[model samples]
Every structure is written in C-alpha cells, then in structure tokens.
Target: AMFESNMLETKQREIVINDIDPDALEKLILYAYEGRLEIHQDNVTNVLRAAHLFNISEIVDSCCKYIEKQ
Candidate 1:
C-alpha cells in the first residue's frame, strides 16, 4: 500500500460524497473517530445506510437494534 509505505503519495486525497446527507456523513465520521455513535429516530436510516455502504458492521448492528426496540 503506497499510503502505508509513505511512498509516492500526496498529502491530501479527494473524496466525492453524494446522495448521503452532509449531517449524516459528519455524524458517521464522528462515530469513526470517537468509536461511538448516537443513533436516533431522525438519523437512524441514513446512518444505517452509510454504515452498510462503508462495511461498518458495528454501526449497522447498532442501528438495527435501535430500530428493533422502537
């Protein structure tokens, strides 16, 4: 991995995010950084979708459990 080897890599990378809401993306990043996420009725579906796309099983499961309890 060039990024892991620190070879021939730029300092910045460009990522294009579409379809997902900005607020939901922000919350997902926050969850990734802090290892915790607070899922609520309003954002659950969006967050869950993001989690599934990103292959984040923990968040996906959390969202499912939250939905089940609702």
Candidate 2:
C-alpha cells in the first residue's frame, strides 16, 4: 500500500496493489506505517521475503518468530 498523493481521494489513500499480491508487498508498508500484521501459517514466507528485501528490522524479527513456531 503506497501513501503517495492521489487525485481520486481528498487525501492519500491506502491503495491495494493488484499486480503484486498483498502478501508479497503488504508487510513492508504495513509494518512501516501501521506497525502490525497477523503473520501466521498461511503467508509467513511471503511476508518474510518482502521484509528481507525491504530491510525492515521489526518485520524481519516478526517473520523470524513466525518461522520458529513451526
């Protein structure tokens, strides 16, 4: 979800990207802006990969914890 300016909305909107699955790109922005997400059995790997690519420390730690649960 990018926070860039959009003429469609009065203010910036949380745009859901279609080309990229939410799992692959959601956590970086979500964790960066909102600081949380339910990373569980289903989408943990995708989130982890996104976090690693984006170099978000909090997200990386969260992903590690999810992995350890298995």
Candidate 3:
C-alpha cells in the first residue's frame, strides 16, 4: 500500500521506518529474499519484535523457538 500510494510517485521515493533497529531491519530484508536468518542472543529480541510488527509469522515463530531453547 505504501509503495502503491503517492509516496513512491514523489521524487524522493523513500519510505522511512521509524523506531526499528537498523540491524533487525536488515535481517528482515535478507530473510524476505533468502527464506532464512540467524536468531542469536544479541538480535533475537529485536528481530522478534520487528517480525511481529511486520506480521511475518515465519520469522516470529523462528524467533520464539530460538528464545525457548535459550
């Protein structure tokens, strides 16, 4: 919706995501294309939060499993 809107038609064509960790965002983007990502002690929490916010169930489930094992 965001991309289909006038936001993309503008000259800037930039979508700003606020209040998300840069590293978590990068991991989510990679996971979208690769179908996999690393969930570690350092990033699991942030990644899980980001995944939940984006409604990415796969990542959220994986993060939950990783957390449970810790």
- Per-residue lDDT tens digits of candidate 3, residues 1-70? 5556676545465668887898999999999989779779999999999999999999999999999999
Find the 10 residues in a row with the least total lDDT in model 3. 6-15
- Which candidate, 1 or 2, has the higher TM-score? 1
Once fitted onto the true fold, the runs of candidate 1 whose alpha carbons sit more than 4 angstroms away are: 1-12
RMSD of each: 3.4, 5.3, 1.9
Which of the two candidates, 2 or 3, achieves a greater TM-score against the reference?
Answer: 3
| TM-score (C-alpha, index-matched) for candidate 1 | 0.76
Q: Give the candidate order by descending TM-score.
A: 3, 1, 2
lDDT scores of the candidates, listed in order:
0.83, 0.69, 0.89
Worst window of 10 by summed lDDT in candidate 1: 6-15
lDDT tens string, model 2, 1-70?
3234545443635634444456658656666677667688888888777777667677778889878878
For model 3, what is the error of residue 59's alpha carbon versus the real structure, in angstroms, after optimal superposition? 0.3
Where does candidate 3 stray beyond 4 Å? 6-11
Whole-model alpha-carbon lDDT for candidate 3: 0.89
How high a TM-score does candidate 3 get? 0.85
lDDT of 2: 0.69
